[model samples]
Target: MTDQPSTDRLSEARAALATAMALHEQGDLEGAEAGYRAVLALEYRATDVLPLLAGLLGRLSRAEDALIAWEQLLAIAPDHAVALHEKGLTLHWLGRTGEAVAALEQACALDPHNAIAIGNLAVVLADAGRNHAAIGQFRRALALQSDNLHLRHQLRRLGAASVPFWHIPMMNDAPRNDAFEAAITAAIAVAGPDARVLDIGAGSGLLSLIAARAGAQHVVACEMEPLIAEMAQQIVAQNGYADRITVHAKPSTDLAVGVELDVPAQILVSEILSSDLLTEKVLDTFEDAHRRLLAPDALVIPRAATAMGCLVASETLADYAFVGEVSGFDLSPFTDFAQQRLPIHGTMTAWQRLSDDHELVRLDLTQAKHDAVLTRLRIPVTASGRAIGIVQWMHIDLWPGVTFDNHPDRYTDGGWLQILHSFPTPVDVIAGETLDIAVGHDRITLILLPLTQ
Candidate 1:
């Protein structure tokens, strides 16, 4: 009972589709596009033709047209995963990042097992500055497809971009890890097994994990960087410490007594100090934790830190700290704009100590308040040389008996690097003379300058 007109129209539609496919295969994209449009106009198998048409448009660099095709397909089948995924890509191409993320998220949700969809969603999320969420999604996809090199590359890329490069080397530092473990163990031994612990700046969740492994029953940790916090959560879960440790992707100041913690933490373990001490906001972080997050008499790891330094003279370091002339130009004025602080690998660098090590400044972490400190330092010169800067390192008193320092003498491999506090200019001195210099911190950065003549 088929009418001749209907049968003929159907036959014509089939022929048009076959020709369109042949044209597409033969690299005649315009011809293929026309044929595809003609078939769609005939209202024959539009669903099957949509993806092809959209793909061809994309290949032809017609993003707007491709987006329109995907939109039309979505209109027909709202939950179509392919259409949504393609639409997300098109939106991203058009610089509509928000819309792309929304569309890609929808696609990922619809196809939970699709690694491609999940990866694309993660890419868009990262682009939208939702780094934490993006890291989580990428991890989920990577878990499904562990052999995907691209996924691994992206995970490391995001991590490296969001975190400092030294984090990995620091984590790999066995000595540092042992010291922190000993401190955490000591804290737990003193506070007992039921002591509640708070770890601030929980990078890689290592310190928090240490607390958990050390048998702290209840622990709360927080990190301000969303990407780092999210990765920490994964690391904690992977190490099977997720039950004991809860990571808040917020600053320590954002935590509260009864909200983020059931009670004020009884032991506060934090390692947020920079090479110079206060640059990582250690003073602010510890102060805030003491005021709000920690108990009145909470045990603080690394109860004190000392800035240890010795006058150093190096022809090599002088080049890094000062520039006098370049290509016949008196660039001595440029020395005024030289880096006030420079990180140095003391063992690898060519430097001679002009004076023995001395304590430039020290901070008691047990205290809750801090003020700017400035004082005079008298360095007893032993070897006569051009003193370009004061080479400084850290001595952390993690516990009563456990002290650690990255002294330029024996400590060579670790996260800590010797810092050079360059003088306004080089100073000439002889043996048995005292180099009077101003030394201390402005509560944020160390201040070092030789007393000008």
Candidate 2:
């Protein structure tokens, strides 16, 4: 008699599960959920009913309930790939990025051939700001599903968005490229054909290739951006220099002398100088390279760099630097939060010089360490109205005679632009008067402050 009752209960559970599935197909999620729970209460196919209940809860936007259902399913079937993937998606939707990445990564490992899981994992990774890892995952998913348009679009978007826009133009910059190549050849000639060269910030492996072609026996290049580093490796191979050059996806600080390089590098080539000359952490990077990765006297490219600028007054630029009455309302207080630096294409912008070019600051890369600098500069104003700011550019001394500068008057169509370091407030000045200002660097930024006399 007891056996007969157990049989009756099993029949009842099976009927309930059938009814729940019908309700789910009919779009009655609540009814389906109730039926699935009743089936689980009977302990009949709980593993099967748990997934149904969890998916229904997710559809109902009950994420917490859905998570509980998924955890229960996982407890029953620990290796359930689908359950893990769904749980990861839920966690991502709930803004639990770290946990989501962990879960999806696990799912991808369990079901390596599952394209959906891989793509979803890539999405979660990108959300976590792991762009290069995300790109790698996306590429893997795309390789599995070659005709997937969404996957292709994602790769293209990441390539365009994550990288700075100036990289392409910078590569196309013939004059700049020539100057760097000239310096690289000169350094290689001095260091000899067997020189071990280290190129920091190797975008597209251009400089590494230059060193290899210039007869350097070995070249190790490092780029912090993983996506860019991957491309650099590919480009180096495509150009038939893979045997001579190796690119690492890491910052210069992460590279070591014995591991990335066989020994201390004889030449250290880097083009990390920002338009303002210090914003790229050039001083810190170079100092670290010198102390850890380079020989006693490494040949540094662009041995010294200078920040050159002149005082400027422009009605168009004044509007950018300060705000007064806007639409008949006094918004002058907002001027207190004006932009400190504005990048402008010098030839394209209309601005008049109020003073001759002045050397704002200079950085010697060979130095092992640097301290914050502050100096008082007396400027002899020649033509002045309302001085808005200083228009700054770069002058790079590559070797003894080879140099490059993006001067406002001559350098056009290059990747770099003149940076306007705006004053705190517009200062009215007269021609033939001297303006005293503080000009220097805080190791990472060019400090230009107009002083009151």
Candidate 3:
């Protein structure tokens, strides 16, 4: 014979819970919320009833009330995965990114097999700016739910967005690959099969693999991008060069002679030169390698690089470099803020040369140190018009009898593009006249300014 009052209280609580569920299903959120609170006041199934209340509050856009309900549930059931997951999502919606990441991480750990919870954690991690960790979690979630388009899109958005679009075209560039392979082969022949080789900016591990295939016994490679480095490692393993090539996901500056490399490298291979020759900080990287990582007599591929260009006049390019009145309004002041440099595929854009090619700047990579330089250059005009800018290309001296140039005339389908060094304003000149300009480098950028007569 149970106590009549106790049994009556149980029956009332059950009835209240059933009514709350029915109201919630019928879209009466306010009534459902009241009924849930009534059940909680009766001290019945708090762990279960709190979730219903918190979730309803979330739907109602009452984040503060929902947070309070979730916190109350967490206090009673600290290890509850559902409570933690919902709490984390609420915090994220409120822009409490750090706390959201912490809570979601806890939920993920508690429910390791829950792909949705893991993906939620990844979202919070991304908001917290923990990109690498977010990438890891996204990958884990993808492994379980590979067909989920949202997870795949997020992964690609983070992973592929950081990689330059030119990487694929660069890899498929046959002429560039051939030139590098020839240089690597020649270098290995001179240094012998057992020589130590170091590859800087080891993108996709191509250069390191080239050295390995050329019979170099040991090779060390470094890439600063973590995702790219992982791909390079995978590619190296796929090509059976894993034993000979070691890829490190770090910058060249982070490498040490005795730690990453067993001995000083006898051959250094790198192709960090940008289209402008120095924009990639090639001078600084080479100087550091020469000082710390390489042997005094180490042979450096692409021993010298030159910035070559010819004066050009193009109405097409002028439109991109200069601005004037638009819709009866004077926008000429915007011309003063024009871009100093623009990249264009040589074959794709229409432009005419006004003067012959001239050397703008040259970098001797073998040199241990470099200083900024500026010098006056006088270019003889051939067919003169409005000189909008100079169209620039690169000439690389890889090794003896091995050189590569992406001259706008003969090079196409390669990664490099011809740069247009635009003048602030166009200069009109006549044929058979001389155009004098100052040319040099500030260690990272080419300087080409037309001198006022």
Where does candidate 2 stray beyond 4 Å? Answer: 1-5
TM-score for each of the candidates: 0.79, 0.94, 0.91
Query: In candidate 3, which residue ranges exceed 4 Å CA deviation?
Result: 1-22, 34-43, 127-131
lDDT, candidates in the order shown:
0.90, 0.91, 0.92
* Residue pairs in collision within model 3: none
* Native-to-model Cα distance after best TM-score fit, residue 307 in candidate 3, in Å: 1.1
The digit string of per-residue lDDT tens for model 1 on 138-257 reads: 999999999999999998888778888778878888988899899999999999989999998888899999899988888899989987887799999999988899999999988998
lDDT of 3 by residue, 1-453 (tens): 133336778899999999999999999999999999998888888999999999999999999899999999999989999999999999999999899988988998999999999999988887787777788999999999999999999999877765788788888999999999999999999999899999999888899998999999899999998888989999999999899999999999999988999999999999888877888889999999999999999999989999999999999999999999899998989998998899888888999989988988988999999999999999999996999989999999999999999999888788888999998889997899999999999998999989962
The CA lDDT at 146 in model 2 is 97
lDDT of 2 by residue, 162-222 (tens): 7998898889999999999999999999999898999999988999999999999899999
Which of the numbered candidates is closest to the native, going by highest TM-score?
A: 2
Can you tell me which runs of candidate 1 are displaced by over 4 Å? 1-23, 30-50, 129-131, 143-146, 156-195, 202-218, 223-249, 318-340, 374-386, 422-438, 449-453
Point out the higher-scoring one by TM-score: 2 or 3: 2
Clashes of each: 0, 0, 0
